[model samples]
Target: MNREPLSTKEKLLDVAEELFASRGVEATLVGDIVQGAGQRNPSALRYHFGSRDGVLQAILEKHLTRIEERRAKLLASWPAPGPRTPRDAIELAVVPLAELLSTEAGRRYLRILGQTMYELAPDQMKGVGKYPSLSATIDLMRGCIDTLPPRVVDERIQGTLLLISAMLAIRARDMSSRRRPPLPLSTFQRNLIAMATSTLTAPHDEP
Candidate 1:
């Protein structure tokens, strides 16, 4: 009964990602995704994804794959400020991720990711981990996180993750924010990397 599942799955994910990216995922429904993909099968969504969450997972895998490739390249080039220091490794890892937030696609993906991470209150970390690409990034970040101050590392790690998610979400929330010129993608990411690196690595004042 199933027909061309791969093509259907890909089409569904493509339409859904675009729809979710352009329109908040909450605003778009599974019926809407099926419609956008021009599929007539009433059970198209269920047959393909089994659930909306499944579709989301596929979309995330597509995006994360490209991002992981970039991260690997960057990590491979670890310059003088080598990863021996967690700060250096974290920055090396974060710069590429942050830079994407400044992009149109990145912003859209972030909005959806942010919602999963916070708004919808889903522990997408699990879904994300299902794919090795996303897990690799998290693993790298965790490696850096492991090197931080024990008393505060947990808090800082959680905060940094949240900050990145929030920043990406905020970018989408204000796609047309015109009060001030938006920071260029590279610059914003550079600053974000530094800020996050400093927040975790800087010696805190011990009163």
Candidate 2:
């Protein structure tokens, strides 16, 4: 039986995803991607993607757009005036992403995203539309968010979002490797929703 070989673009994307997940964008050189994808010519990367940043953006867009589209569909079907409970808000953020874990590339994307959150400054991450789905999801939770002190609301929400990403990255890694999951996905998601809800709704003491 014969199998079709990968196109130059496809091979680059496949190798770049794994390399970016393991070594981060800045650390993983353009040449590294080319070499990993089995291309001897360095210009192949440039031919396919204009630059390193373009490649990174392509990778992010591939995953995030899917997530946002899924969120948009979910949001449209949800009750009017947006999510009513903290769990509803949390589900908006988590479920679309959780759906990605079933695929190897999706798992790699999660790891790369977790690393990007730490490796890049805020401006550097803006290429991913500043996470449109998550921003929309959080906006829908403004009711719960309003319960926190105004000063702490921004920080608390940002921190909780980071925690969710980190947790899901770990879960993605575990599932990709076929390791025993610490908890069922549903249980983990419920626990995460509980934690995010508590964090958002927790009262702040005077500083």
Candidate 3:
């Protein structure tokens, strides 16, 4: 079977994702994306995406929409009283993102996502209304650890995101480079979830 060639905009997006992941989003220039996409017209990226931020948002939406669908299905499949434990919530949070590790583009997306999340302030990270599955998962994970002080719980939730993103980004880089991952894929995932669960559920000392 034959597949359609990517449209000009898609070519720009594909190059942008790779460049953004490898070069860091702040460092990847619009002209670089345009040229990398094999476009002769320097204005192509601006024409298609309006600006660098537009392309960045488009890249995020492209991957996140798929992740949202996967997470929604996982949320639906949980037995009654969904996500009763930290591990359950962690799995919901991590697995959909982790599944993206299987391909080069997906791996690049993970790295880019990690960089993006790291750069955002905590307050800026709360606008997940567009990603209901992710929003629900965060709410449930916080509920599971509600015994903690409110501030601590918020920190833990933010920490969980940071940890998952960083670890997945490293794993993606390792896998992409054809280097031996510190652990096999299954072990890496299980340990990553367990570590994230601990980040959320570990007993906190009152200060």
Candidate 4:
């Protein structure tokens, strides 16, 4: 027998996640999610999530929680940080990211995260901060970030984030016909880890 359709609320969130992931938050409107969800109620967004930003906060906070949990586990398993090789710090950030991006759902969410960071609104970022696990990772990164000189670390972090974002968004199949949709998760993860290690460990030009 055919199963009952998802509750209106569940359907809204399901559609919202895909729309937000594929289109970026600002570009994906409430109308679109509601329509895609097949819920004819005109006030569905307001009734369920309260407002546009509220919906964004709910979805992003949920997304970030899962990611940060994995990140914490990865950090916990790694060897403790030494005095000052910034590469150590970079690996701290990279490994878990590679692991997270290795899943099919993770691939989509990873790209959405990049788009979120790129198009970040201060309010939205603050909302993201309210999620416990994610807030902890950001706090930890900031604490360790002080070990390297400010200018150098700043440049490296920015560059690394961009490279990571690109890896998350651009599917492997875009370059090869033999590749399949959503990309193969493990291959993507290994390649990302390799690229991140090489970039982070490279010497600083001026120090």
Top TM-score prediction, candidate number: 3
Q: Which 10 consecutive positions of candidate 4 have the poorest summed lDDT? A: 172-181
After superposing candidate 3 on the true structure, give the runs of residues whose Cα lies further than 4 Å from its correct spot.
Answer: none
For residues 1-207, could you state the per-residue lDDT of candidate 2 as single tens digits? 888999999899888999888676779999999999999898999999998877887998888878888998998897667338777887787788877888888889888777665544333322444667656677656657776665566666666667778888899888877899989988988887787777666768876
Misplaced by over 4 Å in model 4 are: 1-5, 23-26, 79-88, 101-103, 120-152, 172-190, 197-207
- Candidate 1: list runs displaced more than 4 Å: 1-6, 79-83, 99-104, 119-152, 172-181, 201-207
Clashes of each: 0, 0, 0, 0
Residues 1-207 of candidate 1 have per-residue lDDT tens digits of 878555877788878877887677778899999988889986798997888888897777677788777866776676664346555555655666666656667766776777665543223443555445456555555566575555455455556666666766676557634334378656766676776666655554555
Q: What is the C-alpha lDDT of each candidate?
A: 0.67, 0.78, 0.91, 0.62
Look at candidate 2 and tell me the lDDT of residue 33.
94
Sort the predicted structures by lDDT, highest score first. Answer: 3, 2, 1, 4
Query: What digit string (tens of lDDT, one per residue) describes model 3 on residues 46-72?
Result: 999999999999999999999999999
Would you give me the overall lDDT of model 2? Answer: 0.78
TM-score between model 2 and native: 0.83
List the pairs of residues colliding in candidate 4.
Answer: none
The residue pairs that clash in candidate 3, if any, are none
Preferred candidate (lDDT higher): 1 or 4: 1
